[model samples]
Target: MTLDLPLIWAGLIAFAVLAYVVLDGFDLGVGILFPLIRGEPHRDEAMNSVAPVWDGNETWLVLGGGGLLAVFPLAYAIIMSALYVPIIVMLLALVFRGVAFEFRWKTQRGKFLWDWSFAAGSTLAAFAQGVALGALVQGIPVANRAYAGGWWDWLTPFSILTGFALVIGYALLGATWLIWKTEGHVQRRAYDIAFWVAPATLLLIGVVSLWTPFLSGPYMARWFAWPQVLLVAVVPLAVLGAGFLLIRGLTERREIAPFLASLLLFVLCFIGLGISFFPHLVPNSVTIWEAAAPDNSLSFLLVGGVVLIPIILAYTAYAYWVFRGKVNAAGGYH
Candidate 1:
């Protein structure tokens, strides 16, 4: 049986990437919300809420990058090379944030500085990812399995808008998360923040959804095509519904519902993006089959991937399950 190794590898990589985005996304959201909480105790509670799983959450990014490199060397090379600067900035930001989490508690002298570092790092990383996504969606110049565009190509108005949109979106995720993991003043504050941020997030989602279809000719055709259009139409409607649920949950002071609703918005948006791009990894540039490594290479990697990915998922679930509960300010991870 000649299995379509490329297709399998593509699916695996996609799953890894999605896992990274959703899992790490909320924790990063926590960091973004760092400055908003009033007192030291509240901030500590917020930090502890994520401390146990934040490092593990980032493992998905490594898995995604590793899977891409192993399965599709051409796409990996081209995309990474194109996104070198933003990637470096993002990594540096995350590193600083990670260190801040550790060192802030060890010293009282520079705790405030560390807090700002965490917030700045998280915001920068989130914005960088959004910019990278926007740049990819806008399409990079590719020729002969290499980037043909300049470094500045990714720096554009659309990319900036997308970056800010992600900031707001992640902030909403963070606030809703606080609602779930905390109580009293922190929870109430989160509720208040969510009420405003949720609407802005929905507006940005609307703008990005409308703007994205215009950027790619293939996307335009796929989105607007007859019978398919009706089916594709459901994605946006579902996103709107999710947004409404998120707002309602926030207004009603429900704990977990708001987070779940926000998460649904993200999932639907990802699914819509996948539908828009389909077989193209880089959007109208390199295809999965074309960018895929040799079948022998993919087959070797696939074996390792299948065994290891499940282990990662299992441990990630176990960690979340183990740490499940409201974060106590007096009895935090510290």
Candidate 2:
């Protein structure tokens, strides 16, 4: 039997992207909540909550991007051409956020500025990522194997809504994370913020989920068609279950359940998106096979990926295992 290299690579790339979102998302969420955190000590707790794992969480991002470039050069080219502005902005924001992450600990006088920088960077990066995702889901304008859209095509109202939605979602993630990883003032404040942000995130998720189907006929058909409906029906029920648990966790003062619930909500959303975007890498334009690299090249890459991926997973698991437990209020991992 001929192995479906394209399909395999597509799934691998999808997994990488999802890993990035679920892993790096909380740290970015911590940054997004910076303004609401109050006091340098609270912020320190927040930062320390993610200090050991934040940089490592970004490896999936690198893997996802590089995999796309190597495995789907055509799609990468078109997407980059379409989303150059947002992509650039996201990269620059991430750079600023990383600098602030380290330099904040170094300087006493400029610490406040670094704090703002971190917040701005995280917020902007999250917004830009959402916008880029929205634009992609809305479909890139492609002609003769190239992007044919205007520079500002990514700045639509729908995209803006996704941007705001992502910001809210990330804030919720950060708050829930604080709930899991900190105590005293930071934890209480996080619980308070999470109680509000959770509903807002769900509201935006509903808005975006509703708006998505109408963007393309295929999306609507895939969601509403008979057998597909039976299959897709599970997503909404799962989302509702996750939401219920999230609210219950926050209300009952459960520490870790809310964070797990929030992550489950994101996983469901990602799965829903996968349902919408499968087969077509460019959504209505290019198929996975069409955009994929040659089988020989894919085969070579897969060998390396198999070895590298497990190692990555191993180290990531080890890091979290070592750092498990509430972040220390007085001192953090150096």
Candidate 3:
């Protein structure tokens, strides 16, 4: 089969996005789960669980956006234009979360403020990302490859639903991370949260699945088709199985297995979405080839990717390896 540069670029972009969601999603979830509990020791355990790897997790976002700008300039421009406000909000949220992550440890009197800041920032960032995704999936108001809609066009009920879905999704990740990293009371709390959040997230996925077809006729057609339908059906079953296994593993005190299962569920869900939306970077508005940059530009990006992606992978691996093993209450950030 002949290689399609646009399809290759699309796959690369999808990889970057999925990496971001998997890596950063748990850290963001940790932030969201922070305020729900009380006491410093528990909080420290939560922070340390993500401390070694959170920064590295964000690298995927940079790579994803950079890849889009480099190899799919048209799609980048149109998406940025349509999602200007939400993107700005997402950036600010990230900034706030990053700053608060460091400063909260140093300051005592205003620590609560920073904690809330961290949670709020994470929540906003995750929600904005989901909203942007939902808006894309729902289709931007585009004419002649340009966005043609009011600023508020991105803030539909569908976007709102997606936003909350992401919040729950991230919360599930956070809960699982806690299960992996903490012991005793904290682990119990995390498991409890997961028990509740998992079903909610599953429901949200169902809702999105049901709504997506009505929202986009082409998406419905793509999903309901023969072999594709089989693959799509497999994703939900895998997700449900993973979720069920997670609950069982946690209840059985299987330690690390539940976290891994939860991560697998998230990955499966993301893959399902990617499958549903392949070849269309901007839903119905723009095909990947139309949105992609010239072959020469993509070739340049491919060269950069050869070098950069490995370095990213190596550093990420090193970070996780260095930070391996369970965190304890005595083990706080330095």
Question: Cα lDDT of all candidates, in order?
Answer: 0.88, 0.94, 0.85
Best-matching candidate per TM-score: 2
Predicted structure with the largest lDDT when compared to the true one: 2
Give per-residue CA lDDT, model 1, range 50-167, as digits (tens). 8889999989899888888878888888888888888888899999999998988988889999999999999999999998888888888898778899978888888888889988
Clashes of 3: 0
Candidate 2 vs candidate 3, lDDT winner: 2
Overall local distance difference test of candidate 3: 0.85
- In candidate 3, which residue pairs clash? none
Identify the superior model by TM-score, candidate 2 or candidate 3: 2
TM-score of 1: 0.97
Between 1 and 3, whose TM-score is larger?
1
TM-score of every model?
0.97, 0.98, 0.95
**Which pairs in model 2 have colliding backbones?**
none
RMSD to truth, every model: 1.4, 1.2, 1.9
Instruction: In angstroms, give how far residue 41 of model 2 lies from its true place.
Output: 1.4
Candidate 2 similarity to native, TM-score: 0.98
